[model samples]
Target: MTLKSVFVLTTLSLAAGCHGHDHGKSEGGKEGDHGHPHGAAAAELPGQSVTIWAQRTELFMEYSPLIVGQETGFAAHLTELPSFKAVTAGMASVTLKYVDGTTIVATADAPSNPGIFRPKLLPQKVGACELLVDVKSPQVTETFSAGPCQVFASADAARKALGEEAEAPGRITYLKEQQWKTDFSLAVAEQRDLQNGVRASGEIRPVAGKEARMTAPVAGRVELASPAPLLGTFVKQGTVLASIAPRPSAASDSATLAADVAARQAEAAAARAELGRAERLVAAQAAPSKLVDEARARLQVAEAHLDGASGRLAQYNANSSGGAAGRRFQLRSPVAGTLVAIHAVTGENIEEGALLFEVIGLERVWLVAQVFEPDLPRVQGARAAWFTIEGYEQPFVVDEKTSKLVTIGHVINPRTRTAPVIFELDNKEGRLRIGNFTKVSIATGAPKSALAIPEAALVEDAGKAVAFVMVEGEAFERRPLRLGVRSNGWVEVLEGVERGERVVTKGAYEIRLASASGAVPAHGHVH
Candidate 1:
């Protein structure tokens, strides 16, 4: 016989053996006794199965042998219908009621395997019976019923009925333990204020007046401050960054200027002495008062000359103390910021006014979003925005409360036909860097509430957007989704999923692969 025929015949025989017992009392028959062996019911019985679907909780229940005087095992799997993700923890109970007024109740707690519950129930008499299942989860309590079913005298009768029923296909069963082993995660689909907006490309730039260029003040050789500053180095305003000293050819001029300063100092000292002497003579009547006044005038004139010479010398000493050859001008940071560029290296000869270093404060930055000419009108109406930059997992938000719209360009670029719309963002954490390419969404319309999920939950299947939902605790169903506005890290779900459903937010592709490859394991009791 073929394998399929052999399997069927074997199952049928086992079913017949289980139910061939008499309906009368056994040798040890007591008040609840029936002919069938009680011990036999505890063992696995072939060809006897019944499955019940709980619509409220989306729980799927399957049991072996709807036969009296036998121990039946009911396996219940709980899932969230909307997302088709498994329900991991819940309390379950199964009550069997027979027409003869005999009732049996069995209870099972959540298993480590997740979403799978096994309850053992034993029926005492063969008659009409009803099965009632109650499941309690953290979110809700649900009850379900199956069968005003006939509790047959034997397993054979139960198997015969089961053979006529059809089984569900493509039902993937993943246990809780298995999920914990894999990179599985879930999130609730929730109602949120979704803003429909225009998407535009942009870049991060330092806010105006927040950046400064350090340039060489005079033609000289560069000497970097200790721990030479490089790109990305933080600096404070007034901190010396480098010193410049005049070249060899200009050393003589520096010396002459120094000599001139000394000459002025000597002359001012002599005049002050002469004025003191003249004032004493006038008091003693040895000199006229006019002579004393003339001495004082000479002192003032000499002091002015000294001041001018000192002023000239001070210019060269602006940065650092003078050396033997010339004064070394110390270049200090004009603003507190990070050094983003170094145009001149230490010991290199640079001409006056040459670019030296670029410092940019990162505490705040501007997002210069490029709005196409057609979308320029919408940009003016934008009240808020969220932007994502390359290499960042989270988006930065700008709203009227914390950010300001700096400007909207009146001129459009000839090549791209796009205008720059500027918004400033607080980057106190320094997570954002200048010149990073960005994608921005400017909210221009009124906010509306809708169901939404993380953008990561979405995947494309056969050219249609789909998401895996936990229908039963261990079973995930592939669902097609109709998507709407996308903003930040979330996408609006117009259809395919309901609020409260748990969808796979991580490792969905693995589940899809497992389903496609028929690698999903059978659901059973976990030790």
Candidate 2:
């Protein structure tokens, strides 16, 4: 079996119990949905049917009464478990594993239809033992048990032993064939403790202290750096985005300031010379010490004048140069973020207070919602809140670990009668965009415990919300839902469904179509 599975699975053969999902486009009815029932292959039988579940396969067989030296036909409906799809191709063998170690095996090469396999067993001896259906294919090899079955001694004895079919009314008969071919799934209903909350309209925003506005510190012509920091560009703190060439003025002209610095330097040199001469004369007893002191003070004043002129020249020259300088101010990003806006352009001369650029950190964003004034009290005490955006069914949770409440406005809008409520959200996935409209829910009250299911499970039929609850392996019943609170992709069920009961979650539309047509496909195999 291992060697066979290795060769079959390695070849990736779809010829076994496995099949390609795409058969062809459907003609548009239940007949087209799961494939039309294999009516021609089915023939009526007298005895009861047995359905059993194995690790990987489900076998539902309808077989005739067993008797010695008599041939018994078994119509095996093989379905793959978990997926609930048909085992389209496989070799099915029905074997009677007797207590005394004797066995009778019947073999069918392939399914009469996709999920139907017919096998015949000739019991040479009568016994009470396990009925095992073994399916072998490149895709799967599984043996399903129908538990203990009987092989009668004679036909009259068989009639008395297998009495009569039980009364089966109002039991919706969905064949395993239909379930295997259609989109199908089941979800267990369970008790959930959900927080009660109120809904409000909201918008995504950049969090406070995460956004930085860059402006010109002095009146200058804008000069952009290499790879101009365009809108939507990510930048780091102190990354030079552009430079500003200060508009020259008469007082701060580079040439005039340079000349003033030279004159001041000359004055300082002459003062130093005079101070040296005064000190020499004082040492020779030709002048007073006060004259030397006065010379030293004059040199200090001249040097101070030189430094003042030099400072002005550097300031006007953009701090780079006095000899050849105009680019004085280097505009840099104040924070690490995406460059969201650019107000100034290259070579544009602007005032000192003119706006230049805007950068905003998008790693974390704020969800701002407006609550009705009457609902403001509840929002103010909210411990948790979440918001849903387009393209996402579940709301993003705003918790203390990744996010927190930023503020709840006390002031109410006079015209709209709403107050602003804000929550900081983790936008690490980059799903939340600023200015995006959203639906928000804030949990203000205590948690309410009740049975619930996924919001996707409910289907509207004839203006009533209904769910298909599984009754058996191949049966389902519709139950109208009595709804209560809904939050976080789940809806609270007040009535109509019990906890632990399974309901159709996926491929529910097929069930709806089946129910509406009132067609239970023929048991598509012979006994």
> Model 1 off-target regions past 4 Å?
1-170, 173-178, 227-233, 250-317, 341-356, 522-527
**Residue-level lDDT tens digits of model 2 in 107-174:** 88987667777677778777787777788976578766666777778766765665544424444545
Backbone N/Cα/C clashes per model: 16, 1
Per-model TM-score on C-alpha atoms:
0.59, 0.60
lDDT of each: 0.71, 0.72
Question: In candidate 1, what are the lDDT values of residues 1-527, reduced to their tens digit?
Answer: 00110000012123223323221221233422322344543333443323333333455565555666666655565654434455667778888887776788888776323665667777777778777777777743677665455677776666555453332456555554456556666777998998888889999999998899988866789988888887787899888889888766653246766898899999999999999999999999998999988999999999999998888677666655766755687888889999888887788998878999889999889999999999888878566899887667567888987788899899999999999999988887888888889898888888888899988799999999999986544567788999998977789998999887778877688788878887535333210
Lowest summed lDDT window (length 10), candidate 1: 1-10
Instruction: Quote the lDDT for 242 in model 2.
Output: 80
In model 2, where do residues sit more than 4 Å from their true spots?
A: 1-42, 46-185, 213-234, 242-329, 339-358, 472-474, 519-527
